[model samples]
Target: MTIKSLSLKRKKTAPHGLSEPTDLSAYRRIVVLTEGHTNPQKAKTAIGLLRFRGGDVVALLDSQTTHQSAAVALAHDVDVPIVTSLADVSQPDALFVGISPAGGRLPPAMQGAIYQAAQQGLDVVSGLHDFLVDDPALVDIASRTGARLIDVRRNGFRETAKHASFREGCLRVLTVGHDCSVGKMFAALEVERELLRRGADAKFLATGQTGIMIAGNGVPIDCVVSDFINGAVENWTLANQQHDYLLIEGQGSVTHPAYSAVTVGLLHGCAPDGLIFCYEAGRTTTKGLDHVPLKPLTDLRNLYEALAQARNECEVIGVAINGRRLGPDEAAQEQQRVSAELGLPACDVYRDGPGVLANAVVALREQVVD
Candidate 1:
């Protein structure tokens, strides 16, 4: 089959959150405003969600790739139209700031679209570190037009209360990773899905933009103040105390120089009963920092377990590898090697399904009972 045809088929069968109903039901028709950066890697929030939940996508606003199919610009076949301006799109219920540029600052070119969207009485959803509500012009427009400005990143600022002590009723599984973008969220969501499929009560706790978009509610851990990071995570965990399992989405790696604080906070906050360490196959060094070589999977696992155990008894039950860049044979070999070396269940959750990791979590619970 052609590449386009294969992508289309994958869209129908891929286990990437499309099978589940989304919490964004109120936003039935939405426009993704990505402007200059239309590539999927840059416009991940918009492209990723639309790839899985295309029914909600009305159009992608990218002046650079106007009139192009979203599949062509994003490298994923969501089959949505790309319009140059809001004028080109039919009235949409909401306009989402889709691109998350480095430093999290809002791009100047995108300002016009935000203004236009608000003036047209469309709700604005922004995930940038720079809040749209902070801008005087946009705020005035939104206030006058009765358009809601939703900032997904401003989750923990409203509450001054500290987190409750970590309680131990339900089994909590956190997906810790060796580096950024190594499929931590993917593994956590897949494991949650697998557990639910087997008739277990489970909820996937989101800690990032994409996860928040998928679940429709979550604290953006990275955007919270350093002092309140743990409190934010603890609050989310306690709210979902009724579940049999809570699959917590983890953030950056503990070894990552820039984001280690976020990782440390999450580990102590949730006090996960178990962790699924995620690593990218064949990635020898951390992304953007070539001098920082990756530690052995065993070492990473030990570090995570030790940190978690310091607060509460925690174990590294499995390893989830991101083998998207590796061939099938090589990926399988790496999975086997990691499993043997770490002495834990190991597999790429996306490629091999989350059954191995799900089974590992189930077995660990059994051991705890015994």
Candidate 2:
């Protein structure tokens, strides 16, 4: 897709929010707007987009790392130009708001960059809970300039969905974690990508903004009303139930002080066949909640399985370790120790690739069928 395709603007609404999500595959190239923010927690969405977009990411808008390679900055193996802004990238189709900072609010620097991109008629997409589509100024800019404001979190909510009777032999695997942002979405997406590479019919069911943007459409479960979280999960699952493997992106943590509700809701609602326990190797505390020590992986695994047993007989199949903060040797050692301790396959999905975990999950389904 070219920038012209994104300029077919529609006036947005307050309730359901903005224009429908566009299929990302159509975008020939995209510029991820990071505004040079490099904190891993802050730049995670940008990093994820660049990793999984399959070479569609043309440039990264980061003034701090401008003229450097994105691989060097994000610690990923992929290579993409790190440009200052949309102007630096020639004919990029869209601009993605790629920072998932502590608060969902857009930093002023990012806002200015987005405004410029919208004025330049680039369709702007964001997964941030701070809804850009609802901002009157941005709405007006999009309306006047005919550039669509695509809110990945708010748009494309599946309607008229029922509790699914998923396809026979198909599986739903939810990524549960020890804490918020412990690589649940990253692990889930990486496994899905691996399965797809193997020619398996796998789909990633996005429950968060970043996951939704990556998948092109999903329900941001955090944004849903409490009473409707199950319905929302059911809705998204039904939409993708045909795939042989549905990797649902998990949110928060079952033990998280603030976000436990969303975590339990996903566990109960998704009716997963197995869970992938995502963890950061050395993170002892919740990202923001320094007081609540992270539960041991065994405790976490048991709780998740017990919770799943309350509804269906789901189990924790493997562990997805986030070793981004560790050196290569340390990351490998940590994975080995964790795997031996848990008696489950454990690997850093990004650092080591998703093969080990993917095989375990696929084997689970096949073993059950057998």
- Whole-model lDDT per candidate: 0.79, 0.80
Over all chains combined, what TM-score does candidate 2 have?
Answer: 0.90
- Model 1 is weakest, by summed lDDT over 10 consecutive residues, at 7-16
Candidate 1 residue-wise lDDT, 1-370, digit = tens: 1111221112221211112222343566788898988886688787656854578788999887754788888877568888988889765777888876656899998999999988986777788898876787777787687666777776534343364554455788899989988888888888988999999888899888777876677768899888888877887788887887899999889988999999999888887889999999889998778999988877888889889998877899999989978999999898989899988889988679999999998887777533
lDDT of 2 at 364: 87
Which residue window of length 10 is worst by lDDT in model 2?
7-16
Query: How far out, in Å, is residue 22 in model 2?
Result: 4.1
lDDT tens string, model 2, 57-82? Answer: 88888776534777777777777878
Model 2 gets an lDDT of 0.80
| Pairs with steric clashes in candidate 1 | none
The C-alpha stretches of model 2 lying farther than 4 A from their native spots are 5-18, 64-67, 155-164
lDDT of 2 at 79: 76
